[model samples]
Target: MNIFEFIRDPSQIGPWFHQLLLSAGMQEWVANLIGDVIGVLLIVGAVLTSAIFLIWLERKIAARLQDRVGPNRAGPYGLLQTLADIVKLLTKEDVTPDGADRVSFNLAPALMVMQIIMVAAIIPISAGLIGANLSVGLLYFIAMSGIASIGALMAGWASNNKYALLGGFRVVAQLLSYEIPLAFSLLAAVIWTGTMATNNLAMQQGELLFGFIPGWNILVMPFAALIFFIATLAEGERAPFDLLEAESEIVAGPNIEYSGLKFAWFYLQFFVNSLLLACIFTTVFLGGWQGPFVDQFPLLGIVYFFVKSLLVLLALMWVRATYPRLRIDQMMTFCWKVLVPVTLVVVLIVAIGARITPDRSINAVIISGANIVALLVTLGIIGRSLRRDVQRRKAALPGRSTAQV
Candidate 1:
C-alpha cells in the first residue's frame, strides 16, 4: 500500500500482522510486545541512520563550501567515511587522565547523549507517530535541551585539567546567557497557543492566510523565530558562538581529556544536537508537517516535516561552513544587548496581541504587522548605536586609516 493508505489506516497494517501472529499460535501478549519492540527499533534505527547521513552530508557541504575535496577516499562520494571513523574511534585507545574523577568523566558523554536522544520522544515523524504526546511537550523539550550542558561541566571539572575546567565554565556562561532569549522566543509560541503541546502548536500554524499562505508561527512572530534560530546556533555551539570549544584558545574544550569512543560521543553529539535544533526550529516556526495537500494526504506530512527540517539543517551547515567564530566577550554582548532585548519585546508583543484578539487568525495578522514594525525599530536603534560606537572608537584611535607615524 501507498503511504497515504498506510497513514489513513495505520491500524490496518499493525492489526493484520498482530492477528497473523495470533493465528500462528503466538500469545497475544508476546505479539503485542514484539510489535512494540519493532516500533522502538524503527525509531532508534531512523535516528542513528539519519545521524550517519547528516555527518557525511555536513562534511560534503563543508568541502563544497570551501572548494576542497573531503573524505573522497573512504567510500563513494565519501558516504562511508563516518562509519569508518566510527570504527576507528571504536578501536582507539581510551586514555583517561590519571587525576581525572573516574565516575563523572566516564558518565559525561552518556549524560550528554541521553538528553539528545530523549528529544526524539516528543517529535512526531508523521500524523500519528509520536513516541509520547505529553501536554507539556514544549516544556519537556526546553528542559531536555538544557541538561546537556551539565554533562559538559561534569566532563570539565572531572578532568581536573585547567583548560577543561575553563571550558566547562564557559559552557555555563554561554548557555545561560543565550538560553534566556531562546526561552523567551519559545514563550511567544506558548503564549500564542496558550498550550505547550507540540502537536497543538503545529496544528495552530497549519492554517492558511488569505487562502494561500501557510500561517506559520514565523509569520506571526517573526522576531521570535529569528531570535530562536540564532539562539540555536549558540545552543548548538556552532560557528560564531562556539567559544566553549575554541580549539586555538581552549584546545578542544571540555572533552579535552576524553579519548577514543568517549571522544567520539562528544564529536557525534554535535550533529545530533544540530539535527535536534533543526527539528525544533521546523516545529516551532516553519509549520511542522503543515504543507499543501498534507492535510488530506496525511502521510505526506512526514515527508514535508523532514524536508523542512533538512532545509533548516542545511542553513545551519552553511553558517557553520562560512561564519567566523565570535570573541567570547562580543558573543556575550550580542546575547545580552541584542538578542535578549529583541526577544523580550517580541514576547511582549505576542502577549499584547493575544490580549487584543482572542481570535487566532486576527491576532496572528496583528502580531505579524507588529513584528515588522518592531524589527525595523530595533535595527534602526542598533544601527545608530553602532555608528556612535564607531565614531567614539575613531576618535580614540592614535592614527587615521593611513596609520601615519
Candidate 2:
C-alpha cells in the first residue's frame, strides 16, 4: 500500500500499532509491518522537513530582528539551506574514533533519532492524524523522550572522549534537574484538564476559560506554562540552558566524535526534538489542535497548531542567538533555586485554586496574578542584590589608584 492508503486504512499491524489490527487475521502481519514502516517514514520525514523550515525561519526572524539580511540566496528565501547542508553531510566521509567502541558509537545516533521519531508518532496533528491514541499518551511521551539521555551517554562513552563524556554527564544532570518542574507542570494540567490522555487535554482547551475565551491550560496556570517552557528548553538542550553543548567550553559536546551521517543524525534529532517540544507545549498549555477558529474550520486546526509551534520554535531560536549560555553553576542554580521553587509554588497554587473556585476564569485570574506577583518580587530582589554586590565591589577596588595607573 502507498502512503495515502496506509494512512487512510489505519489497519497496519506493526508492533507499534498491532493491537488495533487484531481483527485483520490474514493480512495482519504484512499489513502491520507496512503500517509501521510507513508510520516511521512519515514521522522521520516530518522531522527532517520541519528542521529545514525551522532553520530557514530562525535565520529570517533573527535577521529581521537584528536588521540584517538572512538566507535569501540558495532558493528564493534560502529555504533549502538545511537540505543543502544535509546533502553536504551525506556526501562527507563517516569517521569513527580509533579508540571508540564501534558498536555503541554507531548505535547512539540511530537510537537518538529512533526515540524522537517514536514519540512523534503519538502527537496527533489532526483528528484522524494519530498513530495510536494510547490512553497514557502524555505518560508515553515523557517516558519515551527520557530514553534520549541514555543514547547521549552511550555516544559519550562509546566515543572515548572526555568532553563528550562530560557533555553526556551534564545533559543527564540538567535533564534530571529540569524534569521535576516539567512533571509538575504536566501534573497541574492533569489536575485542571482532568485526564492524562492527549485527546482529553485537547478537548479541555475547547471549554471556555471564563465564558468566551477558550480554556487553555496556560490561562488556568500561566506559571506552570512558563515553568514548563523554560524547563523544556533546558531539557531540549537549547540556548541559555544549553551548558551541555557549550561550544566555548566543550568544543562540540557529546557528538564531537561523530562525523558524516552519524553527526547528521544528531543534528536531525535536535530538530525533531524541537518539533516534539513545540507539540508538547501546544498539547499541555496552548490546547493541542483545539482552538475557537479551528473548531469550525477543522482544517484550520493544522494551521493553528503549526503556526503556534513555529512561533514557539522561533522564540527558542531567538533566545539561542540573543542570550549567552549560562555557566554550569548558574544553569544548575537557576533550575534548583529558581525554577524548582517557582513551579512547586505554581503546582500548590493550582491545587488550592482548583479546590476553591469552580469557575476557571476566577481561578485563572487568581493564579496568573499570583504568578506575576512572584515574578516581579523575584526580579526586584535580584536587582537589589546585584546592585549591592556591584557597589561593594567598587568600594573594595583600588579605584583612584588604578585609574591613575
The model with the greatest TM-score is: 1
The lDDT for every candidate, in the order shown, is 0.85, 0.78
Q: What does candidate 1's lDDT look like per residue over 248-354, in tens digits?
A: 99987999988899998887678888998898898889888788787667777888889999999999989999999999999999999999888888989999997
Query: What's the CA error at residue 173 for candidate 2, in Å?
Result: 1.6
Which window of ten consecutive residues has the lowest lDDT sum in model 1?
396-405
**Candidate 2, run of 10 with poorest lDDT:** 7-16
The CA lDDT at 97 in model 1 is 96
Provide the global lDDT of candidate 1 against the true structure.
0.85
Cα lDDT tens digits, model 2, 145-236, are 67888899899899999999999898788878888888888888887777887766776678875578778888777778888888879878
The residue pairs in collision within model 1 are none
User: What TM-score fits each model?
Assistant: 0.91, 0.86
